[model samples]
Target: MNSEEQPILSIRNLNRQFGSGCRECGGGSGQLIKNYCLSCGTVYACRDLSFDVFPGEVLGIVGESGSGKSTLMKCLYFDQETTGGEGYISTYKDGNANLFAQSSQEKRYIRNHLMGKVYQNPILGLKMDFSSIGNIAEKLISAGERNAAGMEERGMELLTHVSIPVHRRKEAPRNFSGGMQQRVQIAKALSNNPPILLLDEVTTGLDLSVQASVLDLIKGLQRELGISIILVSHDLGVIRMLADRTMVMLDGKVIEKGLTDQILEDPQAAYTQQLVHSLL
Candidate 1:
């Protein structure tokens, strides 16, 4: 992000702990001896994670399974309650208020109106039984849009934007191929033109060719719409293709972060170097 322009979203000391506390493990403080405390079974799913996502930038989070990438995304979207920290979106309250501090109703408003998310599983992101347009309309409905014609028109536009045929708008996502289902999810996520988009391993199970097409569609949409995006994936290749800046996460902590090219070229962390070499 440029020094002059403020980040669209800023996350500060974000923490998500899966257990209450355990004195033997420093009660969620000091050195975390293990992810699970022998005494309390408290799991520190995420540490004091912090990052900023600038408008119109794709910030990629790459890590292996159990690296806490999905957990972080869930916390950001409020699907999983955060244990601690402040989250602010510039589009909300002139960027002066922490999103986590907002009332439940206010939080819902922000989520439905300002942020959009697509999960790895189509079932989570798309309603298999709903028509493609019906699924997109669900978000618009949540945003208080009641005009049926407008919703249909908007859905058509989004489907077209994602390269889905207009005639298929009435078809169920369950009947579409994996790639088509993912495109439907993308359309649904963009239904409200949210400033921030969260994608959690959206292409993990797809064929290589399908993955490439979805990745390309994502890049095109982000550029065309100028939305800030956080793409979580285990694939460094996907991150390299789409991220302007990248954050490397391991065991719930960000080990390294920098321009995508710089991090790939001269990684400082051992884990990051290993990741780069593996790609090579």
Candidate 2:
């Protein structure tokens, strides 16, 4: 690749609006939109967002609850279709291409092989009834690893990497504490060996000590795998520890974005300053 080439993932002018009324008022339905939900009886979940995720870079996206952080991550991962603007994912498998414009089949193929996601709620991303190791191995197989032995080996390695005990690997996630369950979720997300990982508040419900361990596990994995990561969290401390850069969002719009320290130490926007204060 040339030095001038863009990063692995690039999002430009992305917008996502919800509700039926916005659909009628010239804002396309599903992912696109024009007027606010109040005026058109449709909710606007995310609006005019743009960012990039480069290879081996961890970008932290911070916003309060209902600030569209999750929505923006969904759009980048193609879990939610865009209303407008362009999104691109560049990889050796597909070369450089527009993500939103890809056909359903193309998107499915990429999603299965090239990207992985960890939801804020562990239960949302994991099967409560399955053994922790089984859950991770199942995802590996689903992502195209057909070798049983290989899957088991990789699953055990991942479990260990995240600090899950070997014996506990046989236990169902329901038997694990909140932090352990989150580690299992992280292990499962890495099962695919995806080039891009979307972590949506992976540390949300954990206590402070557990959160630190989980964050350390994530940083270690990133160092080993060299995969680009997008971390969505309301916790500034989490972002400060893991992210090289940070983006701040408010009411679906990007209020400020820069290096993590720059934004935290010298916030440019009032919302960003208030968010930092809340952390203190």
Candidate 3:
């Protein structure tokens, strides 16, 4: 990663909370019960989180369930509204504009053009009834492609790039295996050629062999495309395999961050130490 190069994506003080806070827990002054306010019953799913994704680098976010990793992804993708934050994309308005503050139409444009996301649940990212290639076309169309032949050609190229059989391109993702569905989702996500890709627990729940295959595919694609990616996973093994840099989150806050190798060799945080040791 080139430290001198500008980050492709930068997030500042990103915060997402589920409820209005009370006097005690408002403004992040008071806290109780692991990111929850007992008095107000508010959940601070993400708080004052900030990070950057450099060009062609995979930034991993590792955390357990309720660690706010997934919530952070949702905020970045605009799947959920953020309570407060600023996001800058180098390719968007020359990185001068704050993406979180953009108009809804503008956000949609950014989502369709500047970034792609692969959700852990294929249902969230794919239309089950749509053919696999049709799913790719959907994204391409959203990005302003109008020529049917052009879109189909792009879709076929992407599916083949992701190693999905050309013969199965016409089948719905529902008809494919778990790993195949993910491949289709990947192909669809890449259809628009977005600079940034957000992947959330993509390998979770797959069989061990399938998980390895999916991870291998991701590694290969990242190298082949040189696309920047933000990968969210609870498994440190997954992060270690793909992340150039990593941020560890707990209870809605980042407790550690560094190059993946440094974090593994010398984890400063106790929680991070345990996480690294578990892979031994």
Most accurate candidate by lDDT: 3
> Cα deviation in Å at residue 175, candidate 1?
0.3
After superposition, candidate 2 runs with Cα above 4 Å error: 1-5, 21-36, 92-95
lDDT of 1 by residue, 54-111 (tens): 8799999998788888999998888888889999998799889998888889989988
Backbone clashes in model 2 = 4
Residue 127 lDDT, candidate 1, scale 0-100: 82
> What does candidate 1 score on TM?
0.96
Better of 1 and 3 by TM-score: 3
Worst 10 residues of 3 by lDDT: 1-10
Model 1: lDDT to the true structure:
0.90
Candidate 2's residue-wise lDDT over 1-280, tens digit each? Answer: 6623458888888888776554444553343332345456665667788888888899999988888889887887777887778877777345567778888888877777788888888878899999998998878777677888888889899898888998788899999999999889888887878889999998887899988988898998999889899999999999999998999988788889999999999999998999899998
Among these predictions, the greatest TM-score belongs to 3
Ranking of predictions according to TM-score: 3, 1, 2
Number of backbone clashes in candidate 1: 0
What are the models' TM-scores?
Answer: 0.96, 0.90, 0.97
RMSD of 3: 1.4
Question: What stretches of model 1 exceed 4 Å from their correct place?
Answer: 1-4, 30-34
What RMSD does model 2 have?
3.3
Cα-based lDDT at residue 106, candidate 3: 97
